[model samples]
Target: MNRRHFLKTGILGAGTILLGNTLSWAGEIKRDVPIFGPDTKTVGGKKHTPFIKAPKKVKAGEWFDVEVEVGHYHPHPNTKKHFIESISLWIDKLEVASAKFKPVQGAPKARFTIRINKPGKATLRAFGYCNIHGLWVSFPTEIEVV
Candidate 1:
């Protein structure tokens, strides 16, 4: 079998496969993919967030897009007072841009435009925030740019 087969059978689910394929989850921080190292979680322990994702292996100077959405994972759902404070997108270590969303009945949507400015490798992360619960969280989305 090849990589696809290995990934399909070797892991239990999406998150598990992600953790096993990428950076080790045994540390304080972890990324679901390899090329990128451990990701930063909390900004100051007052905000919640997650990382965005895009084509990791793309041609230099090519254009791409990354979309991220965040919502309450709790079975009861969060109260209306809770909402996403901001969403940030980055290429490598540069802070490309950020966005804010108002409280809604459903999940929050954030979009990011990306172009392989240089080449080689890249990483994307999304951060979410909820004021009511006062919690912060992060999830990493990975890709490749040829």
Candidate 2:
């Protein structure tokens, strides 16, 4: 084969390999975040789903504590092989706070102090990621800001 032809073929082959790997990785990462379904009392749901704790009402422009815990009914494992890796708090589709934990060293919980500038109803959601179980989301909690 000519040197130019060989070089072109090699470059195309490398590019194809890289593209294939990237696509596969993206596909793996696109798994839907799990949430409690019709059977909300399942053990998996209790172990993996995040639970949000906040007051029912708060004054506008005043900071309040929001706590997120990975498990409410049953505690999730925190071993070296499996654990909750991170937790994120979202308010009406906007991420407000996040926390990371090390296996066997940190618990899968976080407290975020935040305030809403305007008086209205605010929706809060929490997401927890586990190393073995992918991602889990909590039910939306609504708080009235006065």
Candidate 3:
């Protein structure tokens, strides 16, 4: 075979291998659903934890505001390459509200106004999705209603 042909084939083979590996890596990252808590060992885990600001106790039939944020303790990337895509609020298994974000426009934060007519106990949970990272859920926050 000619030298030029040999070099072209070698380069093409190497590029194909690299592209395959990169695609597999991206697929692996896309499959994970992470749950973050206060005991974050890695900086990423700590930064991904959903920080919820809401009253521990509330009155029945009264409306209240709950704020949710990502990277509360540590800041996450907000650039076009890596950024928080969405933040969602849920009561138990039922989702309450969600906020979407763009690359350079919005932060990973949202405020939800909710009301419970009956006196009972409720659980609040928050979810955040990153452009590079997969889904992340916060530790459950219990609220008392009287």
Candidate 4:
């Protein structure tokens, strides 16, 4: 091969190798994105008490009540209401329903009647959020309904 052709081929081969390495490295590594910051405060980080509880075990084919009550302590001074922004209820890997409520006496109540059709262990998870002290905070509580 001529000297000029050899140089051209060498340059092209090096470029291809560089590009391949870069693409492979990018595909092999994953970077995690933070949803909440390090100092992110939840609705009931400390002062805000999550007044919700549920059973971890229950009998199958039985109807049970799963609920969560929240109170916004030290609410924003200018805000009119300190309420849960949203409530997500899930049972047995399925989204059964959703609920919403504003605290009437510093305790907002969200209640749901869960009926178990099959005889097995089920999981009930609830996610809640509210504005406390002018900052948006999330409250997550879960209970088991058998």
Q: Which candidate is the best by lDDT?
A: 2
Tens digit of per-residue lDDT, candidate 1, span 1-146: 88644643443244333433243332333333222112232232212335344555677777777876554232213356646655556565555767776556545657777676665566666545444332233455555656
Please provide, for model 4 over 97-123, each residue's C-alpha lDDT reduced to its tens digit, 9 standing for 90 to 100: 566554543344577777777766665
Candidate 2, residues 15-91, lDDT tens digits: the string is 33433323222232334432321113667667877889999999999999999998676888999988999998887
Query: Candidates ranked by TM-score, best first?
Result: 2, 3, 1, 4
Query: 104, model 3: CA deviation in Å?
Result: 1.8
Superposed model 3: Cα runs more than 4 Å off: 1-39
**Any runs in candidate 2 off by more than 4 Å, and if so which?**
1-39
TM match of model 1 to true structure: 0.53
Shift in Å, residue 33, candidate 1: 26
Kindly indicate the candidate among 1 and 4 with the higher lDDT: 1
What TM-score would every model get versus the actual structure?
0.53, 0.74, 0.73, 0.46
Clash totals, every prediction: 24, 0, 0, 0
Full candidate order by lDDT, most accurate first: 2, 3, 1, 4
Q: lDDT of model 3 at residue 45?
A: 63
Q: List, residue by residue over 104-145, the lDDT tens digit for candidate 3.
A: 779898889997777889988887877665456676789999
* Highest TM-score model number: 2
